[model samples]
Target: MTPIIVFSVITGYFGLLMLISYLTSRKSDNDTFFTGNRKSPWYLVAYGMVGASLSGVTFISVPGEVANTGWTYLQFVLGNIVGYVIIAFVLIPLFYKLNLISIYEYLKDRFGLKSYRTGASFFLISQTIGASFRLFLAAIVLQIAFFDSFGIPFWVTVLVTISLIWLYTFRGGIKTIVWTDTIQTTFLLLAVTISIIVILSQLNLSFDDAIKLVTTSPKSKLFEWDWLSDRNFFKTFTAGIFITIAMNGLDQNVMQKNLTCKNVKDAQKNILWFSITFLISTLLFLILGVLLYQYALANNIPIPERTDDLYPLLALNYFGLLVGIVFLLGIIAAAFSSADSALTALTTSFCIDILNIRKTKTVQKKTRLYVHIGFTMLMFLVIIVFNSFNDASVVSAVFKVAGFTYGPILGLYSFGLITRKKVKDKLVPLICIIAPILSIILNYNSEKWFNGFKFGFEILIVNAILTMLGLWLITIKPKTSLN
Candidate 1:
């Protein structure tokens, strides 16, 4: 009858993951830790990324997004499919051709050390904040679920949760993460499907009937063509394209998995398959949300103050004991699928980028252990900072922060990869850093000057363009030598 049971089950699940991590990590060295030896199966990585990409934010936030934006978020998912195709065909091939350990290494080869470090440092900062904020959101959920029964402080709960992730990921890195993520994704999807069936049964409706009810519901209707508003079709699709491309294509955390594929062909296959799977899985969640809302309405369940709790609250309270357990499992599945990957990717990037450990042939286990622990503690610190703010929404704030930092990154890469014009390496970092700040200022008052048309995801597109322009302006032409 209390959250103690829920918490216990969740803790046990984490224990299982840690056990798997230890088993996988027993003899893992630097190559295995960072690249998974470039031997990971593409299918496994693709399937696992379904869960990693969605994460706790999607588990809670997608339902809330529906409540606010209707089913039009699917447009963004559609855009993601397009973005994935582009990455599979365009970006992955380039990365594979370069045979890069860290994607940022390409910048160094093309431009100079300053560009390389600039890109890598930006990723470290953004991903660290992004990953920490994600864990903080999940920790908040756990805190709320256990507030009465456990009497644990929020920060303590965060440390306990993150420490478990660190323990699992400290050794095997991507090899361990690939398999574990597949397991976690299974639970995530299964939990949602089971909860959906339970909610429908309580409504005395069959699965087909539930589908009909949802399609007819206002929330389930898709296709919004308005370009002037928040969830507009063009804007959502465009935003989706940019977000997925920037986040998945340009990001070290996400792309590291792709780069682990045996070859460019395999990596491209993974991206394509991942696109299909991600779209289908999200559709399943949205359908579950519609059914959940219908069940709540039919039974007169009181909606929570924040819509994020709608799905879980309905299952835990309205559907009662068995379904409550299932709901808790879903929440935990979504949260950990993401947290584990984030932890692994965070350590992998740091080891490869900031620390430059990958350049060496011999890295000690102790060094890797300390590196993993440092990132683990960093997660704790980031969550504390997020908690300190307490006002911003986790998903939106992350995107906003990303918009500033990642936009310039997108531009820098686009220029170097697509253009022949050389950029001044010394000025690259400064331009990349300043572009986002200026974009933020422009975006702040964009609507005031544009007749109430606010900038959306296109901000990243523009930000990247500006960086490209800056790179062009700052680069000095080659001079005639003494010959």
Candidate 2:
């Protein structure tokens, strides 16, 4: 496909998003922009989350991972269900009771200002890097498909894509995001389902035969009980728990949607339904990967050099132009599903938590407008910088960065909610810094030091442990006076 043509199709899709944003923004207030006025329908939020949680990173990365880990990645998603249940019933209630505008504010009330800023800062760092990496992966596919033709650099494509996202999302914020996410999620699911059907037809296998072929493939195996290794079934499962809890239960990006529901009960229902949809949707993608491998085997299609490119290559070669167009639409949908929400959430958190902007009060209208514009510009700048240095895999980079910030937040909340351990507010920053740095060191050298056993999911555990221990060292217990 021509670069201009591909660009036009992508632009058209985003234009639709822009239209939705325009209509939604007409009713948006600070509450709507930040939390959808706490009145959004649970089912729509749940449906939209499937796409937001997976994104293009999962869309491309999961199938690639399947080629290596078999179906064992599903173990993490299975673990995610346990984590999601905890968030729905346990975490959501805590936030609702606190009546928090920003979830991190609960940390401030429970702990102190230092702890609150620490949590929010960590989220800012992790979410930014993680979101950028997702965009990086999507940009790679678009570049390969179009811009690689005439010496147009990848960075140019990246900037243009970010620009389109920023333009549509600058005004409507979360109210717009909820609806946009639902639309994008629909496209993403359709893309995956259609790709499976196309690949099955190519193998001359009926749907039943195709599924049987996948089920029997080596990549289809799901369980590995080893606890000593990175992909150890138990370890990956545990990691899923921490990842879902830390990122969704605590982070602004995911919970920002949860907070939009009309009441605590509805928010809980939204989270519960989101888990089911996310789990089933990811399984479908994994099945597609297994079938893609089978189709490759049967038809003698050459697998791409990197597994991440497998879906795109197959779409381009195996399905002809029409199917390839559909695949492109899916890729765009997945990419924007997470990216747009991240941009909106980042702005929401920063404006509300850091700038003290309020949607409920109209007096500060001019200041809030500036803050929104400032955040939009900042996003454009950060994405440009992130796109320039693209050397790592999207998933690994996201987890690594997430580990740094999420661990400390996990520790902060755990300490405050589970115990009345009177933490010294002044020393909070040092503990948060030390915990993740130490965890990274352990993550890197754990294998060599521990007889080839390594920390994967256990890294979060260690990070949390280190943070807790650090807090203990810094906190001074008060003496109770006998009355």
Per-model TM against the reference: 0.95, 0.95
lDDT per residue (tens digit) for residues 187-226 in model 1: 7788777877787777789868876888898988699866
Clashing residue pairs, candidate 2?
30-359
Backbone-clash count (model 1): 0
| Poorly placed runs, candidate 2 (over 4 Å) | 359-392
Writing each residue's lDDT as its tens digit, candidate 2 over 1-483 gives: 667767777878988998998888885566667777777898989998888898987888888778788888888888899999989888898888888878988878877888878888888877777787787778778888887887888767777777777777766777888899898888888888888888777777897887688878899889987767688888988889988888889889999988888898999889888898888898999998887777777778888777888888888667776667777887887778777888877877777677666644455545656765665456556666766675655666677678767898888877777788788887898899999999998889887889888777658767987999988887777998999
Q: For candidate 1, what is the TM-score? A: 0.95
lDDT for model 2: 0.81
User: What CA RMSD would candidate 2 show?
Assistant: 2.1
